[model samples]
Target: MSEKRSFLLQKQNDAGKLNQSKLLKAEENARLLVTLQKKKKEVEQLRLQYKLLQAEQSAANKRIDALKQKLAEKARCKEAPRVHPINPPCLETDACLRQTAIAYLKARKQGNASALSRHFAPDCNYQYANNREVPNEMVMNNIRELWEKWPQRSYRLLKVAYRDNHVELIYIYKYADQRNHSIQGYAKEKWETNSAGQIIHWREELHPGTSPAESAGYRLVPLNIK
Candidate 1:
């Protein structure tokens, strides 16, 4: 009977050991599950933070685009030509029309083709001396060529006449080359303005005896001032 009792005690001890191992394994599994859940929470938070960052970046880009558009508008406004407040439209009165003509001459004297072209209509007719009517582009090209030939030149207004939309400008045009060869002559320019005050027709006639070295009584002093 004592031997049987001893065997039973050994079996009971083995069962207790098995039960202990199973409990330890279960605890270890619970710990692993908790760690996995923590890692998942961290990954979710990171994803949410990434989404927020993307949204902020998108908003910033929109703001940047808006600022760029505003800057472009400001630049355009600055570049546009200024209009007189008193005369909202161009060429309202005879005085205003005369001013426009003078402005054209000033732009020509300054050798600013862009400014000069602003005074003309898109399909303006141009004639020089007895030449046939040509497009304004040819006239612009001629002006540029003239400027190249005579870098120093001046057009002094003598008188102005107006008839309806037509304006007659009497001026003394003097020009000199780099070699000091100069010429001066009286010229007449007839300009017709459209309702918009832009020159739609232009004709110029230089009087006789205006050729180089033929201008009467005009003298070029020596460059040496000593």
Candidate 2:
């Protein structure tokens, strides 16, 4: 009977040890499952961050491309040749006439009275707006007075038309008076040049109704004159 009792106690102990081992295994598995879940969450967060970075990079690239296109369009407009409405077929003497006209404008802008006098004939007739015809000397005096009144001035030639010995110029005139009051205007000028390329007759009509925005669209061609 004692041997049987001993055998029964040993069986009971073995069964209890097996139950404890199963419980330890179950706890380990639970810990491993928790660790695997934590790793999975970190990977998902990393994926989300990578996707966000890619979206931002794509947006930046699009903005850069848009800016490049705008710059290219502006460059094209700047490089395009201007076409004048009154542009006609070229003449043999047109180049000389154009040069003289441009030189006269440059001298006027420089406020160089002596240089201006060289382009005019002795009997040159000058008229401004609705004013009466004035002698060349009187015109020079008037120009000097104008220079005194408006110390800062610029002329932007818009168009030039030539017919025979006559040349027409459309220009924008901008000036700031002694008090720093600014004024912008347009002038239409008709000039008759003698065979010696001297200005014999000049008529100018001024229009002060042009808006600044309207004048800004015109491009200025750089002139190199001595």
Q: Name the candidate that leads on TM-score.
A: 2
Per-model CA lDDT versus the true structure: 0.73, 0.75
Count of backbone clashes, every candidate in sequence: 0, 0
For candidate 1, what is the TM-score? 0.48
Per-residue accuracy of model 2 over 156-205 as CA lDDT, tens digit each = 87666666556667778889987889998998777777767667888777
Best-fitting candidate, scored by lDDT? 2
What TM-score does candidate 2 reach? 0.50
C-alpha-based local distance difference test score of model 1: 0.73
List model 1 lDDT by residue over 18-101, tens digit each: 999999999999999999999999999999999999999999999999999999999999999985542232234445655665
Model 1 lDDT at residue 209: 58
Can you give the lDDT of residue 215 in candidate 1?
28
Residue 46 lDDT, candidate 1, scale 0-100: 100
